[model samples]
Target: MALKRKKAYESNIEKINGARMTIETQMMAIENANVNLETMGAMRAGAEAMKNIHGSMNIDKVDETMDDIRDQMDIANEISEAISRPVGVGDDLDEDELLNELEELEQEELDAKMLETPSPVVTAPNVPVHVPAARANEVEDDEEAELRALQASMAM
Candidate 1:
């Protein structure tokens, strides 16, 4: 009886272990399918984006735009070179002759200024003038006579 009971207990334990393993395998399969579904969705979205991008532009248009940019750069470079060159058509200029002409004109102006006549001097009417020593005695005598006459009139 003890042996039979032991065998029955062992059989029940084996059945329980097998059921646990089956449940674990089914969970793993479900997880794998879920991951595959998510990957497919991501791939579909990427394909759509790439298709849209390709539809918008082509290789020929890109090449043409690049060519236009290159041509514009060349034209700009030529214009810059033309602007930097000297303006005259091979004309020679003499620096010494120009300096000599400028010096002569300045000398002529200085000579004209020196030749101008000076203006006359002007004096105020009330200011006194210097007289000779002989004339100064006669002026004093006349001043004394006038003073005496003024005194006689004041007395009357």
Candidate 2:
């Protein structure tokens, strides 16, 4: 009876482990699907932007926009590939490595975006700018006059 009980217990453990693996695989599949959908969305947006540019719109900004879309596609591709591979399938395929690569890709995309958007040159305001010494002298004269008046009032 004890032998039968032990066999049943071991079988249940195996079943639980199998279920866990299946769940993990399904989650990965869902993640891949989401990434693909996002890629499609990015591609659609890029196409629409291109169409607008073709319709006589000044599309100087379209290059950067397209590059951004391309970056998104790259990310989607990376994610899909990562998820499609079975977990722990390769010696170099750890979760940390995958996450680090994704982070690096994201940072690269940010850097590209920063490079694409030119900073607006801020010109100084045209207001009458006075030298600081001149302003300070004016303030000092006012303070002296105020002090003299106070002294005179106290004397009275």
Candidate 3:
């Protein structure tokens, strides 16, 4: 009697395992169907939107509008180029003449400044009054200071 009861329990376990496998397979099928329905809905919505857009558009009018835009853009570019070009910048003109005149003016100003600088006065004995060494921060002239600096550097 105990051996028969053990065999019955073993058969019941096998049947339960088969039922669990069937339920798992059914769940997988339901999940796949849900994914397929969502994909089809999305595809249908996209198709409907595209159909509405196509119904509203005329291809010939679109082409004409694009051509007009391109023509306007071309005209605008031409106008921009014309406006940006420098006026009177002819190949016959010498641009260096203006630079040369500026340089000459600078040289003239330098000469005038040099002529304006006063020379130190000398007494009848021709003795030079010396500046104190401690008060020697005053520059007599930039050219003389530069000359002394050059000489000192060359000596070194």
Number of the predicted model whose lDDT against the real structure is largest: 2
Alpha carbon deviation, residue 90, candidate 1 (Å): 9.2
TM-score per candidate: 0.46, 0.35, 0.50
Against the reference, the lDDT scores of all candidates come to 0.91, 0.93, 0.90
Ranking by TM-score: 3, 1, 2
lDDT tens readout by residue for model 1, 1-156: 999999999998999999989999999999999999999999999999999998878999999999999999999999998888789943476878878989999999998888885767988588566668888789999999999999999999
List residue ranges in candidate 2 displaced over 4 A. Answer: 57-156
Which segments of candidate 3 are over 4 A away from where they belong?
A: 86-156
Q: Who is ahead in lDDT, 2 or 3? A: 2
Q: By TM-score, is 2 or 3 better?
A: 3
State the local distance difference test value for candidate 3. 0.90
**Local accuracy of candidate 2 as per-residue lDDT tens digits, 15-98:** 999999999999999999999999999999999998997887456768778889999999999999998988776857688989
Q: Please write out the lDDT profile of model 3 over residues 1-156, one tens digit for every residue.
A: 899999999999999999999999999999999999999999999999999998878999899999999999999999998888788666466779878989999999999999999999966766677867644655556668899999999999
